[model samples]
Target: TGYGDDHTREIMRQELRERLIQAEREGRPLRVYCGYDPRTTDLHLGHTITMHKLRQFQEFGHHVIFLIGSFTSLIGDPDDVKAREILTPEKVAENAQTYKEQAFKILDPKKTEVRHNSEWLAELGFLDVIKLAQHFTVQQFLAREGFSNRLEDGNPIYLHEFFYPLMQGYDPIGLKADAQVGGQDQLFNLMAGRQLMQKLGVQPQVVIAMGESLPGTDGIEKMSKSKGNHIALLSEPGQMYTSLMKLPDFAMPLYFKLLLGWSQEDVDDMMVRINRGEVEPQEVKAGMALDITTIFHGREAALQGREFSRKAMQEGGIPDDIAEHVILSDTPLVDLLVVTGLCKSKGDAKRQIQGGGVRRDSDKVTDFDEIVRVTDLPTVLQY
Candidate 1:
């Protein structure tokens, strides 16, 4: 597929391969596109699945278009979600800028054609919109699992949500994309593109759907920054490394395959080694984190992340990256940790202090009621 090894092009189907072949034979780069909504300012591990596919397409010498959904974000996408929250134009624009910047860290900038859907979407008059709407119906969207589930659950599915797939389908037609890349959840939207193009008197392009999304540490919901269950690209090296270290061991290999672009054979071998107890899962996970961070922040940053984590764990103290609070005006130890963002909950702070996990200036504290006063020299507290 796309002149790459089999594993590298797992998502590209035979029909898509044929289309790519015809484009190559004619000395043209097949137009391929993926749409990203600006619902969040930072991209998490979840967003990288399609980004990796886009990178593979770029490596295959195809014309890759990254469409920033500035227009669609205003309407919001309810696919695989139960609720829709419309975003303001200003917020959408700001998020779009950040999305492009973070995305370019993985995608080749020179080979990538970055675009804003607002260019065409905003210019559509009533008549033009009517014509585009003629290509699909409400019944089609209701058939989607996301919508059907809401209907069965007594949840309200808004009208704007119905327009998401239509707007997405219009994106491919606007770009004249030979293929669209998306995760398996977007199969409906991807098919919507093919159908829309067919109605517009053009040949329907191929749909390239990736595997399921990478679950977060919870190993349940998709990795999402809003849920505070994401390993974000914008996170500091130390924070990113620590969060990755906390992932459930069972989810490690899946994360490696999806986020690190590890080959199927290599992943299989690692699994075999895991079964044989020859290679520790933690070691493999560390390598996975390094390979992934290296792609975005360079090998040096990856090494730094690994080293910082290793040292912190070895020392049995909080990572230096956690905020330090000056002990001013006699504050309870638990309060200090909570105020400094060191601990998320008061109960957690008390547990750490009781369990001898909390430390002040490298000395373990035995009492949760301990209070300290502010001084010129800051007290390093851990929870």
Candidate 2:
């Protein structure tokens, strides 16, 4: 659960310890929550950080709420460098639809309580909003890096941007949350929750921070859908393998630590081996890819993904990052290949098939005339 830099990690650990002590004294289970703004349909690997922490809380017996930020998502997170387009209620609903189902991939549904902030936030009148706003001064919002940077650079800092933290703060008070899990950037917003709860004569929620924004597939900025640098949770096993395998070698230590929970000694040994040419980085990445694929897709599919990838590497014809094209059942192999643009023509597809250069996963495609089914999706085409 402590998944950040040393500084943030220590702070979160201490907070958790103190919160546990407080809960013991109070003689009740803590109400734990992690709010997710459903800005998009599918969550990437990074978004799961806090969800994992929430799952941890659920495992040992605590009230866990999967708070969907339906209203707050409309505010577009002032923490982002650029303002996000305001989404309509219908759009937000659509985006939120799959969040719980996906989150259940990590959280225990039987123990998890799902709530939409719209249930409360949407009900707030102007006067009620003003009352909430009175809790924080404009200077407080200005202190946030996102807002402050925008203001200093002469970028537009919409007056409504200040309300994001306020609304999020109200979430804990409404739920009487004893602890909250979120990304490091959200600690400030959670602080608002604490402040407001204290003002309202309720105990403040313990803030348990996680990721410092996971590195994207690009290995630069945080993994984000808008940036096209994220690996979606619903990605097929093969696709997931492809994305993990493409991460920069330098990004491995963090990925291993944060995503796979590798120890420092393990990471150091891996780096040392790579530096000494004791093992190829590609091989190490393959293991990591298989491990990750196994997590979401299970061992059998992971093995198949590994075999599919290894075959592609051996063939030297299939590019690792080809865009996927969905093909239906009973589709002729030649037709599918040509449709995918992997072959210049049916003739080319046939030639490749005849030469045994075409493959479907681990098997060589022996017949161009062979029909494919829905089960044959995520096929690897070699020249």
User: Which candidate's TM-score is highest?
Assistant: 2
Report residue 236 deviation for candidate 2 (angstroms): 0.8
lDDT of each: 0.77, 0.81
The collision pairs in model 1 are: 327-373, 327-374, 328-374
Error of 1 at 36 (Å): 1.0
Tens digit per residue, CA lDDT, model 2, 1-383: 22235775676668778888888898988899999898888788888777777877888888899999999999767754667678898999999887888788788999999999998999999999988888899888887888788888888887777888899999997787888888887778877898888878887777777645679998888888878999887777777887889899988887887777788899999999999999999999989989878877789988877766565656655665656554435788789888878799998888888888887755788975688776765576544
lDDT of 2: 0.81
Off by over 4 Å in 2: 1-15, 25-27, 79-81, 311-319, 325-374, 380-383
How close is every model to the real structure, measured as TM-score? 0.79, 0.82
At residue 354, give the lDDT of candidate 2: 86
| Model 1 stretches astray by more than 4 angstroms | 1-12, 79-81, 314-383
- Which RMSD values do the candidates have, in order? 7.7, 5.0
Tell me the tens digit of each residue's lDDT in model 1 across 1-383.
12233543554567777897799799998888888888877787788899889898899888999989899888766745666678898989888766877888889998999998888888888898789888898877777888888888888898778878888888887787898888777777777888888899888878877766889868677787667788777665655776777778788878878887678888888899998999998888777777776777688777776776666667745654464233326677788778878788889888888788887767889877887764323345655
Query: Against the true structure, candidate 1 has what lDDT?
Result: 0.77
